[model samples]
Target: MPEYGPLHGETVIFTGTLKSLEVFDLVRQYGGVPVSIPLIQVNEVEEPTDEKRMKTCSDFDWLIFTSQNAVKAFQSKMERFAISVNEIPCKIAAVGTRTAAALEKIGFTVEFIPTVFSADVFVKQFKPTDGELNVLFLKGSLAGSIIREELPFQVVEWTVYETGAKRDSINSLVDLLKSRRDCSVLFASPSAVRVFSEDAVPSVGWSGYTIGAIGHVTERALLEAGATVDVKPEIYTLKELVETLSNRKDEFR
Candidate 1:
């Protein structure tokens, strides 16, 4: 008989807005079942100002992206405006490896990524050349104002996407919690945590299932909602989160 790992026979649930095949395969590789029930929905915002702002991409000294959604939305806007990636003269900075990978996929070389995948760390660590620099931050509607408020340089923000709770997934999530006690729920974003707490927690409560959070931000959200976090990776990526969960599977049992 083949020896089974700690994650053997575990049912892992993903509650992020976006589903990744890579993340799913990681769970399966560790002998766990991966379920996708998104708790949030992210959509690009369409406005007349999109083209105007995108046209000014070259005017900025640096372009910043904190989320993969921002990168995806930026690419979409660029395509819509018939603007090639080579046309943008500004160097790009991403907060996390996944965000940087997304930018790199679109042919933008990532110039900076913080040691820690957070805005506060990025602002504290990022050192620019001695000059008046203009940074344009492409972000979602729900993104925090840390970059704009904390950075000393002139920072302009462009809202690329809007995130909202996926109310349709509420019932499914509640049912999962009610029926399964041995499952592990993975939360990638605070928005997903908020939705899970607001819509599903009241029905099934926030206990019994193993909880995994991707980063400190999501872990903080889970804590604020009175949920216990059992798994959190040192690195804030989905792959790392799954690996951490797999390594700590014995603890949950």
Candidate 2:
């Protein structure tokens, strides 16, 4: 048996609105079972804010998409505005493979991508020649200020989508927590942390199970909610999270 065999036999649950196929594979590779039960449902808020929509591809020199949801929302609004695929004038940038893939599916090739998928690295690699270089950031409403704070040029912020906690998901997660013998829960974003706390934290006491957070923001949310954060990777990306967890398997044991 493996030294971390006990850790592998444990169950890990992932909850959020985002997809978890990649995280699931990583969990399986490390001899852990992964369960996904979304705590929220993601949906576009309304028609893109008119000012923000007009400023996105037309006025900006570079358009930055941090998530696939942002890319999809932007594309949907582009269709509504009657903007042809080739009519986009700004250079396209994506923070992750998923966001890049979303742009690629819409016939836009990514002009720049950072080695690390976090906002810090994304802002680090961003270079603009002119002070007038406008940057349009397509992201969620709850995102932190990385591009806005770091960039020297003008930034147009747009909130394309918002996530809300779902009653069914909350009920399901509560039931799972009550029945499970030994399990770990992974939180990928602050919103997920908020949703978990709002729904399951009161009912599902956090005495026995382990809690893993993806980044500083999620870790802070977990801590503030009175949950013990057992695992937090240095790098914010999913790949780094898995690598960190796999390497630190002994700690869980």
In the range 63-104, model 1's lDDT, one tens digit per residue, is: 999999999899999999999988897988999999999999
Measured with C-alpha atoms, the lDDT of residue 202 in candidate 2 is 85
In model 2, state the lDDT of residue 210.
77
lDDT values of the candidates? Answer: 0.88, 0.76
TM-score to native of every candidate shown? 0.96, 0.81
Winning model by lDDT? 1
lDDT by residue (1-253, candidate 2, tens digit) is 2335435776777776555487777777777787878776777657626535654466668888988888777777777777776777778889877779889998897988887667888888877565678788888877789888887877878888887766688787778778877677778877888888877888886667878888776788889988888888876666566667666665646
| Ten contiguous residues minimizing lDDT sum, candidate 2 | 1-10
> What pairs collide in candidate 1?
none
Count backbone overlaps in model 1.
0
Most accurate candidate by TM-score: 1
